[model samples]
Target chain A: MVKSKSWTMVKHFEGLPKLEDFKLEEKELPPLKDGELLLESVFLSVDPYMRPYSKRMMKPGDVMIGSQVARVVESKNPAFEVGTYHVTNVGWTTHFISDGAGFQSLPKEWPENLPRSLAVGAAGMPGYTAYFGLLEICNPKEGEVVLVNCAAGAVGSLVGQIAKIKGCKVVGSAGSDDKVTYLKEIGFDEAFNYKTVNSLEEALKNASPEGYDCYFENVGGNYADVALQQMKQFGRISVCGAISLYNDSVPATGPYIQTYMLFKQLRMEGFLVTRWMQRYPEAQKHLLKWIAEGKLKYHEHVTNGFENMPAGFIGMLTGENIGKAVIKV
Target chain B: MVKSKSWTMVKHFEGLPKLEDFKLEEKELPPLKDGELLLESVFLSVDPYMRPYSKRMMKPGDVMIGSQVARVVESKNPAFEVGTYHVTNVGWTTHFISDGAGFQSLPKEWPENLPRSLAVGAAGMPGYTAYFGLLEICNPKEGEVVLVNCAAGAVGSLVGQIAKIKGCKVVGSAGSDDKVTYLKEIGFDEAFNYKTVNSLEEALKNASPEGYDCYFENVGGNYADVALQQMKQFGRISVCGAISLYNDSVPATGPYIQTYMLFKQLRMEGFLVTRWMQRYPEAQKHLLKWIAEGKLKYHEHVTNGFENMPAGFIGMLTGENIGKAVIKV
Candidate 1:
């Protein structure tokens, strides 16, 4: 028998999540039955989605939901072998037993030097998110201006780089000067620290006076209100996240969008990455190829231990991470 | 020379327009040159759009912009014959000289018994607005549920009927009990008076417990906020007008929509009827055929005489009209 450690939510989050809101629990795992594999979580993901999703999908005392890259420690299943790595959504646990039903084994050709944590970061869910959200919804055309907020975060970072690959002029904003510098290094044509800017509207205008043709929206609320007005005629908006508004106990109020949408003939769509579940492999292939070619870059903010998972998640929500936030178990 | 009488805006409207904000002016028109035709306004349209458009497209002393069914009183242009009627966007003037370049002549097969005013109502811009806005943006599939507000007005009435023709279940809401009755008479599966409903949320829930698959939004602000919440997963919204917000001196504030939109994976697009300008004839043909087959119906709120044009426009903005509001000059 092996001991398993997991985190559970003490209560639904009211605003930003805090350390006290989580409780660490330990339990003894039973012997694995035939066809079952014992897996140890190597790296756990902490994302902005967990904040809003907690209110919608979790209850008090329930294990906090998430995904991880894990290694097969022992396997009785014929399809699996010991020491193979796979990505699994078994929540925030150090060890879990699975029948190998939904485990997604990492590609055999995964670059040897690359950290396996990326299976839950870029080249994984975030990569697929930026891939489909920007390409499918915004559909950026060559030479068009594309704007993305939270530009140094996992999804937004990839969104800007992908629009660049498609021949678009990419403009992005992040919360800190360092993140803005990182964005500039990653080939973003324009990058601004939204927190330091005197006015978001002027910052956006200075970046692209011709106005945006495609807006990959990650920060909603006042940022969205101003950004929406700058869309050129027939601009497309792909709403991937509303991190700024997610913490509000009540929904925020802002200027009605219908007038701008009408005059500009804008099309706005909201989507979840899971909507294209069947096409994940296709996105993963492209993401891998780009990384191998040095055309795509990824950064990770890895918290050293499973014990710091709550702090890492809280820090991520507060925008402390420049890229994917993950915990090493 | 013909003396033309027209109404001009005294100044930009601050809120709901007042009678003192308009001034009647008279001007003499020049003799027709070769290729020019003298036309007399027969019937003019007064629509909700005029309220907002006046601010964007007009200034003090400028004649209010509008479209009219006009008779060719005299013609130096060989393509147009005296006594033939055509639709022209020559604003509020009773008489004007045009080069016949952009005039659209009434269909040769137009039913003789129908009033020529229908050229500016059911067979004109409002009809095309409904035809394309709902069909193109919402794209209601057969057996899906559709919800439309302002259900007894020109575009809304047609939108509901067209959804039914497409084999979808339709629910509609109007401001008055009489308008609600009119919606029921037009074959709406469910109809309600929004003004009298205890709660818009309950009203929408009771009308269609399954939630709406398509929403045709004409009235925005609070109505849109409530209606957006009632949309089912993957629902589409066609934003045609925002009559509720048009009169506000400042844009109204409302609950942000991105959260609901994300969870439902909704698509919302705003459009003007002119977006489908080249396809107007296609829409008009279908509208005429449906009316001739008695599958479509039209009602006009005719405000008599040219002098009442401003009053007709104001009344329509105030929701006094049951259907297309027109001034018979």
Candidate 2:
């Protein structure tokens, strides 16, 4: 028998998730059955989506819902041989027994120089989301202005970089001055710290006076309303996430955007990354190529140890992380 | 010289528009120039769009912005000869001198049985808005559930019928019980008076137990928020208007819809009829064919006389009109 350490939801979050909401527990795993593998978590991802999704989809005593990069320590399954790496929906467990279901093996030709943690961070779910959401939904054209909020984080960071690669004039908004500088360094034509900016409308006006053609929305609420107003006619908005409102106990209210959307003929679409599961490899391939070409950059804000999962998750929710937040197990 | 009677915006609207906001005046038209034509108004359209668009795009003393069907009384341009009928942006006017620019002549092979006034109503901009917004944007599929608000009005009425023709289950909401009955008579699978319903959410849940696949949004604000919650994953919303909130001096607050949209992977697009200008004839041909086959029906709530333009427009905005609202001058 092998002992596994896991974080389980002890209580549903009320406002911003508290450390007491999650409990670290140990479980004993039996020997792997035929077609089953024993895996050890290498890196665990903490994303903003977990905050709301946990409340909606999970219950108390359930393993905290998440994705992780794991290495097969022992295997009875022929499909997943021992010593292979995988990206799996294995929750926040340090060890798991799986039948290789809901898990994707690390690409066979993954660049040797790339870090293994990237299997759950950049070049993973967040990267794939930014790739498809921006290209498929927004379809930014050359010389067109593109705006992204939560600009220093995992998905938004990649979105701005990808827009730049597509020859778009990219503008981004982050929460801190440091993030703004980082976003500017990563090819954003203009980056503003939304927290310090007196008005997002003025920041947007100063950034792109002509108006944005495409908006990759991560921060919804008032920011989205302001962005919608500044959008050029027939603009497109890819609604990826609403990190700003994730922890709100009460629903936030702002200017009714449908008015601006109608007069401007704007298209705003919300999407989940899994919608493009069939085309995952397509995005992964392009993302890998971009990374190899030095056209895309990634950053990981990793919390060390499996016991620190709750801390990592809480920190990510409060915007303490600069990029993809992960717990190194 | 001809004396042209026109309504000009005397002051900006405060709450609901009043007769005092407009002034009826007469102007002397100069002799027709080489490219000019003289038009006698036959039918004037009163629409919900003019309520907000006028405030944003027009100035005091400007002619109340509108579209009208007119008979060409005299013409110096060969493209438009005397006796031809045209739909032009001549505003609320009894007679006007136009340069023949931005004017479209009535279909050359228009059926004699169809009223020429339809050139600005059912078979006009409203019809085209419903066509492209529904077919191109929402793309309702066979057996899909489609929900349209303001279902007895011009665009919403047409949207429900079109969705039915596409083999979708159509549900609609209107303000009055009479309007709801009219919607059901026109092939809606279910109809409800939103004002009578205990809760819009409960109404929607009862109407579409499986959840809506397409939403034709004519009434924005709270109605939109309720509809967004009941939309199935990957649902589409074609936003045509926001008649509900058009008259509000203060923007009403509702549930921030981005939360539901993201969870459902829903797509909501706002549109103007002009977006489909290139494909106008295609939609017009289809609409005309449907009308001839009796698959599509249109009702015009017309207030006779040019002086009733304000009344007709106000009535349409307040949900008093059953279908396409127009004025016969």
> Local distance difference test, per candidate?
0.93, 0.90
The sequence of per-residue lDDT tens digits that candidate 1 reaches over residues B145-241 is 9999999999999999999999999999999999999999989999999999999999999999999999999998999999999999999999899
A-chain TM-score, model 1: 0.99
Docking class of 1: high
Candidate 2: C-alpha lDDT: 0.90
lDDT digits (tens) for residues A1-329 of candidate 1:
79999999999988988899999999999999999999999999998888888989999999999999999999999899999999999899999999988877899778998898988988999999999999999999999999999999989999999999999999999999999999999999999999999999999999999999999999889999999999999999999999999999988999999988887889999999999989999999999889888888999998998999999999999999998999998
Model 2 chain B is weakest, by summed lDDT over 10 consecutive residues, at B252-261
Clashing pairs in 2: none
Stretches off by above 4 angstroms in model 2 are none
For model 2, residues B64-140, the per-residue Cα lDDT tens digits are: 99999999999898888899998999788999888788887788899899988887877888889888899999999
Look at candidate 2 and tell me the lDDT of residue A152: 92
DockQ numbers for every candidate? 0.87, 0.85
- Fnat for model 1 comes to 0.85
Best by DockQ: 1
Instruction: Identify the CAPRI category of the predicted complex in candidate 2.
Output: high
